[model samples]
Target: MQFIGPDLKGASPMNPTYIEQLFVKYAKINTRSDPARSATPTTPGQTELAQLIATDLKTLGMSDVQLNPANGYVTARLPSNTARKVSAIGFIAHLDTADFNAENIQPIVHPNYDGQDIRLPGATISVAQFPIFKTLKGQRLITSDGTTLLGVDDKAGIAEIMGAMQYLLAHPEIQHGDVAIGFGPDEEIGKGAKQFDAEQFHTAFAYTLDNGRPGDIEFETFNAAQATITIDGTAVHPGNAYHTLVNAIGIAQQLLNHFPENDVPEQSQNHEGFFLINQISGTVAHAEIDVIIRDFDDAKFEQRKQWLIETIATMNQQLDQPRIQYTLHDQYHNIGTAIATIPEIRELPLKVYRDMGLTPNIVPFRGGTDGNFITQKGIPTPNLFNGGGNYHGPYEFITVEEMVTAAEVVARMIIAHGA
Candidate 1:
């Protein structure tokens, strides 16, 4: 299988002219995911971005370029260009940003960054707060204007994958196997991968370009779930209120009290488990509370989920009828357990980094990723870097150097495996 592609001049991993263009083009779209929405994508922008990327994949001469409107996942395949019996591999990235204001996202480019305080219209990237900037001196930096999020969390990953695909397509001299890649929505809220069709996405193993830093690799992620509790009460006039009158709002407050104050999301950090009451709604007659649970340890994660169920049960016993009912949905578990089975998937990226004169930095992510669900399915899916920092906020930024480096890592992994 052969196709003609343009000779991309000055487009190596070190020189990221092609990748930077793709980053800027993707970073401008407003694809902020909504957890509240019941749809798979939860936002129209995600599907729009998927459509654009799908078109680009077709233009790049990829096969099976399908944009699934049902789940907002764009899947494509680049058949093996070599006859060396190379095993097919997969790569994935999300299309949506975090839950923040994402309207008219105008990216600001910093050429030859001076490593100083970067003041934006809505926020400032302080050096004292983020010392990582000091190390990246004289590089091309991309940031938000401060009013809205930069949307670089997964967009950078998307750009890296697309850029690498373009680079691979052009330079057919770099022999590789069949490459399968996908882009989906609602990763921030942790619902995107729930609808992924792993059986359909055939691959021997996969990698997710969702991590941060140049050499970042993550096999362990937070064991995650969400709980929604609803309360029903009898509202009566204050003047005529008696033992018969039950206040649902007061019961909602009591449920909040049952959670540990110090173990909430705001107070917790790396490796610590927490129960977060993300959304609360109440009235005298009806009330509801939404909570998300997280822990890296499997046993401890179960304990957290059990505690919620037991607390709700105890509260129900005190009521005349079981007025409190809740639903718990497990989002994803740690990929470490799954990735451990296939050692090659984990070692491939590390070898690539070491060969590139970079050290492999293994991180236990505090949050979940699309890889969690995919890894749990069957094929081992480890995570690689997206080359960005300060994710899910206004201070978010991505560097052209690291973005291209990440793409190179992806390409090299294929060459190493295929060879």
Candidate 2:
């Protein structure tokens, strides 16, 4: 019952080394997306990663491998090898890394971990900062050398999907329905799934391999939105007088004070909503403050949005003129609403973990994923684990063995559904 690869008897085992090699190759690529850019892929490296994945899928005996230039999405299909009629499903992953220093990424390998502080060139992966290192004491861990992010937030996911497809193709003995694969760009910047075509993916449901460990299933994510407040100040000579000049920076500070001090990312936990100030910049003439709002409950999410609108109105009343302007846009919503239509999709992973004799770690995802937006597009997509830890930072790490487990879970999920 230790389903290391395909759950079926006599099924071929997943190549852990193969998955590791692919991960290392993809990780070395600097696919960091730029939020400053409005382009679809955001960066050139993301389009490059998408192209590479399309070629890999084609070489792995996949059909209909198409790379859409408009949005940087690489989608393919593994035609059904069985006669049974079943719905097609998919596995998706993003190609870009988070916003961090991603140049010259050197993935260091600790073949034998000793449970000590890992000193690198720019930083240290210590047990104190990340106590989870103790649980992964002796595993073969891969990490960045402190100068850059390891890109494991999603590249590990790409490798797992590739490894799973390679295994299914090499064997051919396992009967299954059509299996779809999607690799998109700029997910780190929260813009990847915006242009995804659910009809083109042609899947009844899909799983996005994001940042998490094996045996973990995430069906719920935060209802997310972005808010920006722009203040226009009447810049006058400081010597001329304080009464005529309105300091925009001072108004920005006053606006920030209106936000709940306790309701922030660092203070919030499971199911707790937060208001994160993503960016704030400007001079006395003009200033802007960007915030991100997230909540699990729809009512609370709406209320949070209403609070921002009301706060802006009340603060503008005190001013001589209405110089404060704002813009509010939804980023994504919780996947719970979409998946509720297909309750079985959420339960399948639990059964897969039980059948594999692994404990199920079902929890509410504190952040949003590509699945949140993809689900809103009609397909019930939930998040699967990529077997990595401490994502989006220098201390990020993942074990090769866990990568194999992630690949195995992909294969098992496919068979459990359509085989």
TM-scores for all candidates: the values are: 0.86, 0.90
- Each model's lDDT: 0.85, 0.87
Query: Once model 1 is optimally superposed onto the true structure by TM-score, how far is the C-alpha of residue 407 displaced, in angstroms?
Result: 1.0
lDDT of 1 at 347: 76
Candidate 1 residues lying further than 4 Å off, grouped into runs, are 1-15, 35-44, 119-124, 237-243, 249-254, 318-321
lDDT of 1 at 167: 72
How close to the true structure is residue 279 of candidate 1, measured as C-alpha lDDT? 94
Residue pairs with backbone overlap in model 2: none
- Top-TM-score structure, candidate number: 2
Predicted candidate 2 versus true structure: per-residue lDDT over 158-272, tens digit per residue: 9999898888887777777899999998888888898999989999999999988778889899999999889999898899856898999999999999889899999988899
Which lDDT tens digits does candidate 1 get at residues 20-59?
8877888888999887889878988888889888888898
What does candidate 1 score in Cα RMSD to the true structure?
4.1
